[model samples]
Target: MGPVAALSALGDRTFGSLRRHRNYRLFFAGSGISFIGTWMQQIAAYWLILELTNSPVAVGALALVQTLPVTLFALVGGSIADRVDLRKMVIACETTMGIQAALLCFLALSGVIAPWQLYVLGLAQGVAVALNAPARHTLVFQIVGRDDLTNAIALSASLGTTARILGPAAGGIVVAAFGPGVAFGLNAVSYAIVIAAILAIRLAPRPQRTAPLPGILGSVGQTFRYAVSTRRVAVTFFTLILVSTFSFNFDVLLPLVARLTLDSGAQTFGLIASVFGAGALTGSLVLATVGRTRMLLVLVGALGFGALQLLLARQDSLPAVCGLLYLIGIFYIIWGSSSLATLQLAAPEHLRGRAASLYFFGFMGGAPLGGLIAGSLTAHGGTRLAFTVAGAMAILIAGVGSIVLLLGRSARARRPRTARESAGV
Candidate 1:
């Protein structure tokens, strides 16, 4: 096939889910555009923090604020998702986030944006995110249902990865030429688009919550019990906890890579970050086409992702590192999409929101500790050392997850055999 033919085929494959599901199509289309704007703000926010403080630790603190709320409130949010209309919750959260972005824009444009002010906005953003993410994830299930769960997640994951490509690449230029204010303003407007999309989504009537609502803490405890009891769910969450804490602080690593490692500027950071996204988008599309949530893929992808990050840490040249990042991005998305799909499929319908919120809890909870580790190590030994440690932790967790998977497989194998033996006797 020629280049144009290949491009057309790619588009068809990547968007197959959208073609099949109307509600999901609307949700994905609007969310996709908004995701780009969110990333634009994300990259610019990191850069802005670095500019104000010139400290890696300060940037890490920014990550802390961005994540800590999710870590703290994701369960409550998840609990809320179980009790409410996901569409309305998502709409409210998006509105709140948009207002927060507008405030940031004003702060930047007025030339009075302090590091504390940025941090405060981040805390607000985090709360909305904590509340927003689980409902948003569960809403996809409401749109597409369980049979398409993995495929839907792959496509959904693509929104963020693809945004990584356009958002940061454009953000770099906008921030470099104009300022972070303009990017923030664009992000604010982007949220309005998502809100409109949410309004347009026509979901099947959700199951009535006939049981009295559990206390938020009680609901969270129930989700935890469910997660740990199901073998696949258990393994998936453990792997997320382990790898996410160490290997997933790209926000911390990327800025340091540009400033400290490459001795470069915003454009370089933006470009390389987009390169990473290109690799990630490639992986997301590949997984979506395959349409399987095999545990084998998740385990193997995690192992490879870590090893590649280790390789990435060793590179000094921008060209070489960019190449490594591209490969790492591929592994990263494959692992993430597979894990998320598995969790969604494994959870019972009523508990889906809590399950997803717990997933984010594990996913982002490590940011505080991970950010500190990245900062302290980068401050002393540089990005190389921080990444090396991050990579090693990922590998260690992958190994543990693999053991759990194999043992589960072996146990499953023995069960039917034992039953057959009794029948034979």
Candidate 2:
């Protein structure tokens, strides 16, 4: 095939899910715009924190404030998703988030913004995230059904990756030219677009609860039991805990890496994030096309994710750091998308909402502590020490996982053959 033909073919494969599913297409297109604004706000928020406090610990504290709500409330949110009106829940939560964004913008514009207020607003936004995650994630399964679910999910991730690529770069420029408050205002408006899209969606109705509904706590308990019993999910969740706690502190670490280590500002910070997002976007597209859910490949990608970061710790220049970040982002998405699909696939449809929430439970659970660790390391030692510890921990967790899986395969391989196989036809 010619080069242009190859590009077209790749595009077709990458977006196959959108072509097949109308509802997902709407979700993807609308969410795509909002995601860009989300990324922009993320970049601006991190920059603002740094400017106000000039303390690395405060940056990590910001992560803690946002994620602690997820840890505390996500399980309950998942239970509500399984039983309630998902579309309505999502709309309500998103509106709350938009209001929080508007408040932040007002504070910033008025010259009264402080770290404490930022933390308080972030806590409110985090509650919305806690409520929103399960409903929003599970809603996709209803839209596209099981067979096409992974592809749709991967495509959604690709959308987020694309937003990441655009958002930070734009945010960096905006912050430099305008200010962080303006970026926050843009985010507030972006939520309306997504809300309109959600209102446009029509889902196939599901059966009403025919029996007495289980208590919310009971339903959540059931999900916990199911996940622990499912070996693949258990392992994957463990890995997420490890990686999320350590390797995923980029928002906390990167600003310091840019301002202190690289002697740069918002543009460079945005560039660093955008470059990683580009590589992550590539990885998401590849996964959307292939849509693999095998456990082995997930571990391999995670190990590579960790290994690349080990190399990242040694780099001091922009080119070198960005290059390493790009590769790490590829492995990051590969591991992330594969494992997420695997966990969702493992659950029965009724329990899928809670299962999805459990995924984030592991995914975002340790992040608060991890942010603190990253911040402390950077404050005391430097970015080098922070990256070194994160990289090493990821390597350790993924490496152990790989070794256990291989040994299990080997043990099964050595077991006695079946009578039919021993007799040989």
Candidate 3:
């Protein structure tokens, strides 16, 4: 079935606090614009790096500049989220990202952009996300209320996927028709939409909690313990790490595939990425209709994504990759949204912000390491080898992880009844 048809069927059953919320609609709309712009800049930035450096290591380094900061600081961001007004924190971070995007655009337009400059700017953007992502997630429950947490997250995921589809396509067109600077400039302006969304909300005051620790390491350790103690939260984070390792490489790999394999240009690379977003959009629609509490959806998505990656790796044809990426995108959205929903449902109300922050910490923060390793492998071994290795590893990891989860469930099921336990060990 088509996306709209599938979504319509899925939307028949609604649950949670989000079903009737007006403010959530506004927030969802604005977040969509912002997400689209962010994706646009991302596609443009990767293409720009490829154009400037012509080296895989340089491209990987640039990607590293964008993700390394998050790995280092997202837990701290989570702590900030719990202590401060998350809405205000998100606005501040979005503002910083806007400025960073503007600066990159100006530098590129003025013919003064260099490899080092890109890395520097990328680092600044990474810092923005380190602060923004956790706060943004934490604020969603505030806007929609705890009852609608699952729906709110699903809607946001759909919007994000929609943006993913639009941004790369638009960025590709802009880069081909104008240049990277124009794409960056548009991304800068896009942040205004998100800022306005944050301003428009009138949320109940969030609970104020004491800051957890003095330094970054201490805070992270605390957050880590909390996540592992929560079954769904821990499972979701590891799932994201694996999925990202296998699938997140698409954007990183696209430039190479375009220039070398497809004999294409910036526009072609952007189109391929956009196709992935399109798939994600489809996945998101499926999620939106599927209702809440579907934990098994994530496992299904993981296996599906592994299969898609395997298909992409075996084929040398760009068209084949495009089709496979769409499927990959769909599964990715399912995996991501399902996991986030589960985590939000499973977390203690008081610790939701911290839990969400730790989630982003592992997911987005781990991207750099995964990208770096994938890029290095690809550089030495070529695209097929890189995809082959990554795809195989992802499939194996997912299979093992799923089996373990199942076995654990079975073990728990076999435990003696509570009444029997009271009687004897």
TM-score leaderboard ranking: 1, 2, 3
Tell me which residue pairs clash in candidate 3: 10-289, 17-147, 17-148, 279-330
Name the best candidate (by lDDT): 1
The TM-score, computed over Cα atoms with residue i paired to residue i, of candidate 2 is 0.94
What shift in Å separates residue 56 of candidate 2 from its native position after superposition?
A: 0.1
How do the residues 174-224 of candidate 3 rate in per-residue lDDT, one tens digit apiece? Answer: 988888899999999999987997799877766655554445566567778
- Candidate 1 per-residue lDDT, tens place, 77-107, comes to 9899988988999999999999999999999
List model 2 lDDT by residue over 235-316, tens digit each: 7878877888988898899889999889999999999999989889888877887865779767887888888887988888
Q: List the residue pairs that clash in candidate 1.
A: none
Q: What is the Cα-based lDDT of residue 401 in candidate 1? A: 88
Could you tally the backbone clashes for each prediction?
Answer: 0, 0, 4
As a whole number from 0 to 100, the lDDT of residue 17 in candidate 3 is 31
Off by over 4 Å in 3: 1-19, 208-218, 417-425
User: Could you give the C-alpha RMSD of every candidate to the true structure, in order shown?
Assistant: 3.3, 3.5, 3.8
Give the better candidate number (2 or 3) by lDDT: 2
